[model samples]
Each structure stands twice: as structure tokens, then as C-alpha cells.
Target: AQTVTQSQPEMSVQEAETVTLSCTYDTSESDYYLFWYKQPPSRQMILVIRQEAYKQQNATENRFSVNFQKAAKSFSLKISDSQLGDAAMYFCAYVGVGQFYFGTGTSLTVIP
Candidate 1:
């Protein structure tokens, strides 16, 4: 079984600043995929970044980057230059053996 955990239920960052959301997962599968998704009030899930377990390098998409520690099963997201639009509910997800698991989520607020 695989599960994702996000310790912080809510986070706040100043506009144009940076914020990091923490996530950890437990999985027995050797090969899998980890992802961070952002969902706004519209309830649309947007892919922020993804990382392959076999890959040693972390994944990055524009201002969104991940610090993936495969050995420790930690996949945290770093959001740089935060903007108003970045305020949303962030979910950490794990996909292994056709099974998908998502964290409870972390609500992010961008303060101007």
C-alpha cells in the first residue's frame, strides 16, 4: 500500500516570495511516480511537477520545483516568486502499480 502525507494543513506566503510545502510517502514499489498538484477554487487539478522514482534528479516546472529524496521517500515542492494565482490547495500524490494515493492537501494563501 502507498500513502502520502502533508504535515501542514495550511501555508501562507507573501506575494513575490517563496514557499515550500512538505510531503512524504510510503511505498514498497521500487519504481513509481510522485507528483504535486494544485487545485484552485474552481476545483481543477493542475499538474505542478512530477518525479520518477528511478531518476536521481528532481523535477522542475518553471517556478515550481521538487526536492525529491528517493531514499527517504520525501518529495517536497518549492514555489518561487509566489503570486496571487498560486494560492490554492496543493496535493501530494503517489502512483505505483496502477494505484494512486493523494494527501489530504495543504491550503496555500498568497498575501499581498
Candidate 2:
């Protein structure tokens, strides 16, 4: 069984600032993939970043990065230089053993 958890339901960051969204998972599978997805008002799920369980290095895409701790079952997303456009519902996901799990999601608000 695999499950993803996002402790923070809502977060706010000032424009041009940075914010980190926390995630944790419970899984017995040794090989898996973790991902962060952003869904704006349009309700489209956009892949923000991903981390492979076999990789020790965290994954980063543009101003987005992840801190993936396999041992601790932790995968967190950091958004740097946040813009108003970045405001959205962020979801943490896990794919393993042919199963997909998603967190409840964190709503990010960008303050001008």
C-alpha cells in the first residue's frame, strides 16, 4: 500500500519569495517515483517535478526543486522566486507497484 500526505493544506508566499511544501509517504515498495503536480484554476494537472527513488540527488526544474529522502519517506517541493502565476493547488504523488497515490493538496497563494 502507498499513501501520500501533505501536512499543510494552505500556504502563502509573497511575490518573488520562496516557499516549501512538505510531503510524506508510506510505502513498502523499494522502487518508485515521487512527483509534485500543480493544478491552477483551469483544473489542469501540470507536472512540476519528479524524483526517482533510486536517485540520491534531488530533482530540480527551473525554480522548482524537491528534497527527496527515501529513507524517511519524505518528498518536499520548494518553489523559488514565486510569482502570482505560481499560485495553485499543489499535490504530492507516488507511483509504485502499479499503484498511484495522491495527497489532499496544498493551496498556494501568492501575495503581491
Candidate 3:
């Protein structure tokens, strides 16, 4: 069974600073996908970033980036120039079996 684990229960970032959320997983399959989802107070799951297993280089989208270590089964998300809008619950997930398995989730609070 493939499972995602997020060790950090909570994280905080200063507005205009950067924050990194850590995640690791155990999987038997060689090819799979990882994703970061942001759920704000509105309770909508938004895709912050993603990394495909075949890619060696990390993925980046504006202020979001991922440190994907396939060997270690680790995928982390870095949020730069944080804003109050960035405050939300972040989840690391594995996509397979036509669905997603999510981590416990990390609550990020942006201090201004």
C-alpha cells in the first residue's frame, strides 16, 4: 500500500518570508505522482504544485516549489513571499488507484 506521511502538524511563516513543509511516503510502485493541496477556510482543495516521478528536476510555480527526492520517497513544498492569503491547511498526497491518499495535513499560519 502507498501511504503519505507529514510529520509536521503545524507550520507558520512570516508574511513576505518563506516556509517549507516536509513530507515522506512509502510506496512499492516505481511510477506515481505527488501533489500539494491547499485548503483554506472556504474548504476548497486547491492544487498548489505537483511533481511527476519521471522528472528529475524539482517543480516550481511562482512562489511554490517542491523538493522531490524519489530515492528517499520525500516530497516537500516551499512557499516564498508568504501572504495572509497563504494561511491554510496544506496536505501532501499521492495519486494512484484513481484517487488520492492525503496526509494528516499541516496548518500554516502567516504572521504579519
Candidate 4:
């Protein structure tokens, strides 16, 4: 069994600044995938970034990037030039075989 854990229940970032959200997971399997998903007030899940266990380079997309430490089982999300639209609930997830697990979620608030 695998589980994702998010230590931060809530986070706040200023507009145009940068913020990092932490996530950690426990799993026995060596092969799997990690992902960060954002859910806005509208309640739609958006994939922020994904990292494969076998990949050494972290995944990045525009203003979003992930710090994936496979050895420590840590995956963090960094948001650059934070915008008001970035405010949402962020989840850390793990997928392997036929199972998927998600963290409780961290609510992010962006201050302009």
C-alpha cells in the first residue's frame, strides 16, 4: 500500500512571487509515478506536473516545476510569478500498478 502526505494544510503567496508546496509519500514499489494536481473553486482537477520514477530530470511547465527526490520519496511543487488564478487546492498523488493514492490536499491562497 502507498500513501501521500501533505504537511501544509494551507498556504499563502504574494502575487508575482514564488511558493513551494511540500509532499511526501510512502511506498514499497520501486516503479511508480508522482503527480501534482490543482483543483480550483470550480472543482476541476488540472495536472500541474508529473514525474516518473525512472526519470532523473524534474518535470516543468511554464511557471510550474517539481522538485522530485526519488530516494527520499519527496515531491514538491514550485509556482513562479504566482497569480490570483493559481489559488486552489493542490493534491499530491501516486500511481502504480492498478492503484492510486492522493493526499488530503493543501489549500493555496494568492494575495495580490
Q: Candidate 4 at residue 40, lDDT? A: 99
Clashing pairs in 2: none
Q: C-alpha displacement of 90 in model 1, angstroms?
A: 0.2
Worst 10 residues of 3 by lDDT: 93-102
- What clash pairs does model 4 have? none
How do the predictions measure up, each by TM-score? Answer: 0.98, 0.98, 0.97, 0.98
Q: Whole-model Cα lDDT per candidate?
A: 0.94, 0.95, 0.95, 0.95
Model 2 TM-score on a 0 to 1 scale: 0.98
* Tens digit per residue, CA lDDT, model 2, 18-100: 99999999988888999999999999999999899999999999999999998999999999999999999999999987777
- The sequence of per-residue lDDT tens digits that candidate 4 reaches over residues 80-100 is 999999999999999999877
Q: Model 1, 62: alpha-carbon shift in Å?
A: 0.5
State how far residue 44 of model 3 sits from its true place (Å).
0.7
lDDT of 2 at 34: 94
Model 1 CA deviation exceeding 4 Å by range: none
Error of 3 at 37 (Å): 0.3
Question: In candidate 3, what are the lDDT values of residues 15-87, reduced to their tens digit?
Answer: 9999999999998887789999999999999999999998999999999999999999999999999999999
Model 1: weakest 10-residue lDDT segment is 92-101
Q: How does residue 99 of candidate 2 score in lDDT?
A: 73
